[model samples]
Target chain A: MKMVLAILISAILVDNFVLSKFLGICPFLGVSKKLDSAVGMSVAVTFVMLMASAATWPIYYYILVPDYTYLNTIVFILVIAALVQLVETVLKRFIPSLHKSLGVYLPLITTNCAVLGLAILNIDETYTFFQSVVNALGAGVGFLLAMVLFSGVRMRMESATETPKAYQGIPITLVAASIVAMGFMGFAGVADGIFG
Target chain B: MEKKGRLSLLFNGVIKENPVLVLLLGTCPTLAVSTMAVNGLGMGAAATFVLICSNVVIAMLKNVIPDKVRIPCYIVIIAGFVTMVQLIVKAYAPEVDQALGLFLPLIVVNCIILGRAEMFASKNSVLNSALDGLGMGLGFTLALLIMGSVREILGSGTWFGIPITAGRIDPMSIFLLAPGGFFVYGTIIAALNKLTKGRAIKRKSMGCDGCPSAAACGGAGTGQCPPDKEGQS
Candidate 1:
C-alpha cells in the first residue's frame, strides 16, 4: 500500500508527464486553448493511458518478453491504434454522451506519444503489474492537472493586450507554459519528503 | 500534383515548410531530447533514418494500401522502421540509445513522420518522397541541433559537453531542465516569427488541416478541432 501511494504521488507531482518530462506535448499545445477542450482532451488521454497500459503490460510480459522484445515498438503501436478504434466505436454505440464529450479526442490520442511513452517506461522501469497501473493512473492525473493549469494560463494570455506581436500565438503560450513548468519544479522534492 | 521539381521539394522542407518550426509537428521530442547538443544530434539522425525509410516505403506501397486503412498502414510501416532503427542504435551507439530512452520508440507516433507520409509520400513518386523525407529530416535535425546548442550553452554553459564558460560564470542549471526547454523553444519560435515577418505558417494555421488523422477523423474539413467547443473560448 505504501509503495502504491509512493508511485502514485511521485508520478503526479514529481515526474509529471507534461510539465516535467515533456510528453504528450502535441495535445498539450493543440487542445489546451480552451478550458473545456483541455478537460476533454485530458480525460480522453488519461483513459487511453490506463487502457493501453492494461493491455500492453500483459502482452509484454506474457508474450513478448522471452523471445521477441525487439518487436515491442511495432507490436505496441499496432495494438494502440486498434485499441483506439475499438474504444471509439464502442463509446459511440453504447455511451453516446461519453463519446460526444471524448470522441473527438479519441482518434487523435492514438498518435499521442504520451501513451506510448508511458507503456514503454513501465517496461523500462521493470515495474510489476499493479505498480504499472498505479503509475499510469498517476501519469494520467498528472497530465490532467497540467492541462487544467496551463489552460488557465492560456486563457489569461488570450485576453492580455500588452503582449508584443512577436510573442503572440504559440510563442507566448509556450512562455506561459515555461512558468507553469517552473511552478511544478517547486514540487520536485515534496513527493519524497511526504512519502519517504 | 502541383508539379513541384525535385530541388524545390527538397528546399521546401529545409526552409519554407520546416517540420518543427513552421509546421509545428513533433513538439514532444523537440522539447525532450534537446537538453544536450550531442543527444539532439543523435536523436535527429535516428528519426531521420526512420522518416526516410518509412516515407520511401509508403510512397512505393501507396497504391497497394487501401484508402480507408491507409493511416493504419502508414503507422505499421513507420513502426517497423522505428524498431529497426531502435535495434541498430542500441547495437552501434549505446550512448545515444541511452540518451534518447523511451523517446526513440515514441517516435513511432511522431506527427512529423506520419504527417509527411500522409501529406506527401502517399501522393508523390518514390524518389520525390525520399527527397521530401530527406529535406524534412534535415530540417527537423537542424531545428533540434539549434535548440540543443542554445539550451546547452545557456543552461549548462557547455557546447557539445565541452566547457565553454571556463568556470568564470555560473551556469543556470535551469536551462537544462524542463522549464528551460520550454523557454528556449518559445524564444526560438518568437525569433523565427520576427525574422519571417509572419510569412511562415504559425500555430493558428495548423489545426486539423495539417493533422494526418484529419482525413478519417470526425473533425474532417473543419479548420477548428474539438469541433463544437470553438465558440466557448
Candidate 2:
C-alpha cells in the first residue's frame, strides 16, 4: 500500500511525464492552447495510457521476458500501435460523444512518447502488473495536471501584449513549463519520505 | 517542385530543418539525455543511425507500401532499426545504454524518424532520403552537443565528465535538472530566432504546424497545411 502511494505521488508530482520526464511534449505544447482541448487531450491520453499499460504488462511478463528480451522495443511498439487502433475503433463505435471530443488526438496518442514511456518505464523499474497500472494512472493524471496548468498559462500568454516577437510562441511556453517543473521539484522528497 | 542539390539537401537538416532545434521533432530525448555531454552525443548518434537506416528503407519501399497503412508500416520499419541500435548500444556501450535507459527504446516513437519518412523519404529517392537522414541526424547531434555542453558546464562545472571548475566557482546546479533543460532549450531557440530575424524557422503560429506528425494527424484543427502556403493554395 505504501509502495503504491509512493509510486502514485512520485509519478504524478515529482517525476511528471511532461514536465520532468519530457515525454509527450508534442501534445503538451500543441494541444494545450485551449482549456477545453487540453482537458479533452488529457482524458484521451489518460485512457490510452491506462489501456496501454494494462496490455503491455502481460505481454512483457508472459511472452517477451522469458526468451525474447531483445524483441522488447519492436514488440511493445506494435502492441501500442495496435492497441491505439483498437481503442479508436471502440471509442468511435460505442462512445461517439467522447470520440468527438478526442478527435485526432486519439490517434496521436499512439505516437505520444508518454504512453510508450510508461510501458518501457514499467519494465525498467521492474514493476509488477498491478504496480504498472498504478504508475500508468499516475502518469496519465500527471500529464493531465501539466496540460491543464499549461493551458491556463497559454490562455494568459495569448492575451498578453508585451511579449516580444522571438519569445511569442514555443520559446515562451518552454520557459513557463520550466518554472512549473521547478515547482514540481519540491515534491521530489515527498515520495522518499513516505516510502523510504 | 524544383529538385534540390546534393549539398543543400545535406546542409538542410543541419540547420534549416534541424530535427531538434528547427523542426522540434524529438524533444523527449533532447531534454532527457542532455544532462551530460557524452550522453547527449551518444543518444544523438543512436537516433541518427536509426533515422538514416529507416529513411533509406522507407524511401525504397515507399511505392510498395499502401497509403492507408503507411503510418503503421513506417512505424514497424522504424521499430526494427531502433531495436538493432538498442541491442548494439547495450552490448558495446553499456555505459551509454545505462545513461539513456528507457529513452533508447522510446526512440521508436520519436517523430523525427517517422516525420522524415512521411514527408521526405516517402516522396524522394533512396539516396536523397539517406542524405536527408544524415543531415537531420547530424543536426540533431549538433543541437544536443550545444545543449549538453551548456548544461554540463553550468550544472556540474564539468566538460565531458571532466571537472573544469570544481573548486574555481560554484555551479548553478539547477541547470542540470528538468527546468534547466527547458530554460536552456528555450533560450537557445529564442536566441536562434533573434539571430535569424525570425526567419530561421517560422514561429508566427503555435499549432500542429511545427509538429512532424501534423501531416497525418488531421482533425487537431490546426490542419496539416503550413499557414504561409495556405494562402497561395
Candidate 3:
C-alpha cells in the first residue's frame, strides 16, 4: 500500500507526464484554453490512460515478454488506436451524454504520446500490474492538474492586453507554460521527502 | 496542388513548411529528446528514416486504401517503421536508445509522420512523398538540433558532450528542465515570428487549419474537439 502511494504521488507530482516529462503537450496547449474543455479532455485522457494500461500490461507480460518485446511499440499503438475507437463507439451508443462530452477528444487520444509514453514507461520501470494501473491513474491526474492550472493561467493571459505582438498566439502560451512547469519542478524532491 | 518541381518539393520542408518550427507537429519528441544535441540528431535521423520509409509505402498504397480507414492504415504503417527503428537503435546505438528512453518507441505517434502520411503522402507520388519526408525529416531534425544545442550549451555548458564553457560562465541547469524546454521553444518561435514578420501560419488556439488529423478525426463526426485540439506536438 505504501509503495502504491509512493508511485502515485511521485507520478502525479514529481514526474508529471505533461509538466515534467513533456508528454502529451499538444493537447496540453491546445485544449487548455477553456477550463471546461480542459476538464473534459483530461477526464477522457485519464480514462484512456487507465484502459490502455490495463490492456497493454497483460498483453506485454503474458504474450510478448519472452521473444516479441520488439513488437510492443507497434502492438501498443495499434491496440490504443483500436481501443480509442471502441471506447468512442461504445460511449456514443450506450452513454450518449458521456460520449457527447468526451467523443471529440477520443479520436485525438489515439496519437497522444502521453498514453503511449505511459505504456512504455510502465514496461520500462518493470512495475507490477497493479502498480502500472496506479501509475497510469497518477499520470492522468497529474495531467488533469496541469491542464486545470494552465487553463487558469491562459484565461488570465487572455485578458492581459499589454502582451507584445511577437509573444502573441502560441508563443505566449508556451512562456506561461514554462512558468507553470517551473512551479512543478519545485515538487521534485517533495515526493522523495515524503515517501522515502 | 500546384504543379511544382521535384527539387522545390524536396526543399519545401527544409524551411518554408518546416514541420516543427512552422507546422508545429510532433512537438513532444522535439522537446523530449532535445535535452542533448546528440540525442536530438539521433532522434532526427531515426524519425527521418521512419518518415521517408512510411511516406514511400503509404504513397504506394494510397490508391488501394479506402478513404474511410486510411488513417488507421497510415498509423499501422508508421508503427511498423517505428518498431524497426526502435530495434535498430537498440542494437547499434544503445546509448541513444537509453537517452531517448520511451520516446524512441513513442515515435510511432509522432504527428509529423502521420501528418505527412495523411496530408502529403496520400495525395502525391511515391518519389515526392519520399522527398517530402526527407525534407520534413531534415527540418524536424534541424529544429531539434537547434533546440538541443541551445539547451545543452546553456543548461550543461557543453555541446554534444564536449566541454564548451568550462569556466567563463556557469551553466543554468534550468534550461535542461521542463520549464527550459518550453521557454526555449517559445523563444525560438518568437524569433521566427519576428524574422518572418508573423507570416508563419501560427495556428490560433482554436483553429484546426494546420492539424494533420483534422480530416480523419473532425471529418469523421467527432469534430467537436476543434481540429486544433490534437496539436499535441
Candidate 4:
C-alpha cells in the first residue's frame, strides 16, 4: 500500500507527465490557454491514458511478450488508435454532455505520446497489472495537475502589460513552465524517502 | 496542379517550415532526446528516415486508401517504417538506440510525420512528397542540433560527451534538465521569430488549429476553432 502511495505521489509530483517526462506536450502547450479547455483536455487525456494502459498491459504480457516482442511498436500503436475511436463512439452515445466537452480532444489523443509512453514505460519498469493501473492513474492526475496550473499561469499572462513584444507568446509561457518544472524537481527524492 | 519549384520546396523546410521550431510539432522527442548532441542527431536521423520513407509510400498509395480510414492507413505505413528503423538502429547503432529508448518507438505517432502525410503527401506526387520529407527532416535535425549543442555546452560543460569547459565555469546544470529544455526551446523560437520579423511563422492562437493534427481532427475541421475560443463565445 505504501508503495502504491509512493507511485501515486511520484507520478503526480516528482515525475509529472508534461513537466518532467515531456509526454503529451502537444495538448499541454496547445490547450493550456484557457482553464476550462485545459481541464477538459486533461480529463480526456487521463481517461484515454487509463484505458490505453488497462488494455495494453494484458496485451503485452499475455500475447506480445514471449514470441513477438518485435511487433510491440506496431501492435501497441494500432491498438491505441483503435481504442481512441472506440472510446469516442461510446462517449458520444452514452454520455452526450461529456462527449460534447471532450469529443474534440479524443481524436487528438490517438497521437498523444503520453498514452503510448505510459504503456511502454509499464513494460520497461516490469510492473504487474495492478501497478500499471496505479501508474496510469498517477500519470493522468499528474497531467491534470500540470495542465490546470499552467492554464492558470496563462490566464494571468494574458492580463499582464509589461511583457516585451518578442517574448510575448510561447516564449513567456515556456519560461513560466521552466520555473514550475524546477519547483517540481524538489520532489525528486520524496518517493524514495517515503517508500524506504 | 501548378508545379512548385524543386529548390524552393527543399529550402522551405530548413527555415520556413521547420517541423520542430516553426511548426512546433514533435516537441516530445525534441525535448526528450536533446540532452546530448549525439542523441539529438541520432533521433533526427531516425525520424527523418521514417518520414521520407512513409511520405513516399503514402503518396504512392493515396488513391488506394479509403478516405474514411486514411489516417489509420497512414499510421500503419509510418509504424512499419519506424519498426524497421528501430530494428536497424538496435543492431547497428546500439548506443543511439539505448539513448533514444522509448522515444524511438514513440516517433510512430509524431505529428510531423502524420501531418505531412495528411497535408502534403496524400495530395502531392511521390517525388515532391519525398523532397518535402527531406526538407522537413533536415530542418528538424538542424533545430535539434542547435538545442542539443546549447544544452550540452551550458548544462554539462561538454560537447558530445567531451569535456570542453572543465575549468571554464560552473555548469548551470538546469539546462540539462526539463526546465532547461523548455527555456532553450522557447528562447530559440522567440529569437527566430524576431530574426525573421514574424514572417517565418505566424504566432496564432493555440489549440486544434495550431496543431498538426488539426487537418484531420473533428473539432477543428468541423468549423469549431478550438475549445478555448468556444469558451469565449
Which of the numbered candidates is closest to the native, going by highest TM-score?
3
Candidate 1 colliding pairs: none
Which candidate do you rate higher for DockQ, 1 or 4?
A: 1
For every prediction, compared with the true complex, DockQ reads 0.58, 0.53, 0.68, 0.57
- Strongest candidate by DockQ: 3
Model 2 misplaced regions, further than 4 Å:
B1-4, B218-233
Error of 3 at B191 (Å): 0.9
How do the residues A128-181 of candidate 1 rate in per-residue lDDT, one tens digit apiece?
999999999999999999989988888877899998888888788888889999
Off by over 4 Å in 1: B1-4, B216-225, B228-233
Give the per-residue lDDT digits (tens) of candidate 2, residues B1-233: 23568889999999888878876668878988999899889999999999999999999998999887788889889999999998899899999999999899988988888888888999999999999999999999999999999999999999998999999889999998999999999898889899988887653444654556766554223234322221000
Model 2 steric clash pairs = none
DockQ score of candidate 3?
A: 0.68
User: In candidate 1, how many Å is residue B89 off?
Assistant: 0.5
Compose the digit string of candidate 4's lDDT tens values, residues B1-233.
34568888987888878888877778889999898888889999999999899999999999999887888888889999999999999999998899999899999989889889988999999999999999999998988999999999999999988998899788889999999999999898788778878665554544554565765564322334455542110
lDDT of 3 by residue, A45-132 (tens): 9999999999999999999989999899888988898899899889999999998778878888888899999999999999999999
lDDT of each: 0.85, 0.84, 0.88, 0.85
Answer with 1 or 3, whichever has the higher TM-score.
3
Residue B133 displacement (Å), model 1: 0.5
Clashing pairs in 4: none
Error of 2 at B171 (Å): 0.8
B-chain TM-score, every candidate?
A: 0.90, 0.90, 0.93, 0.91
lDDT of 1 at A169: 83
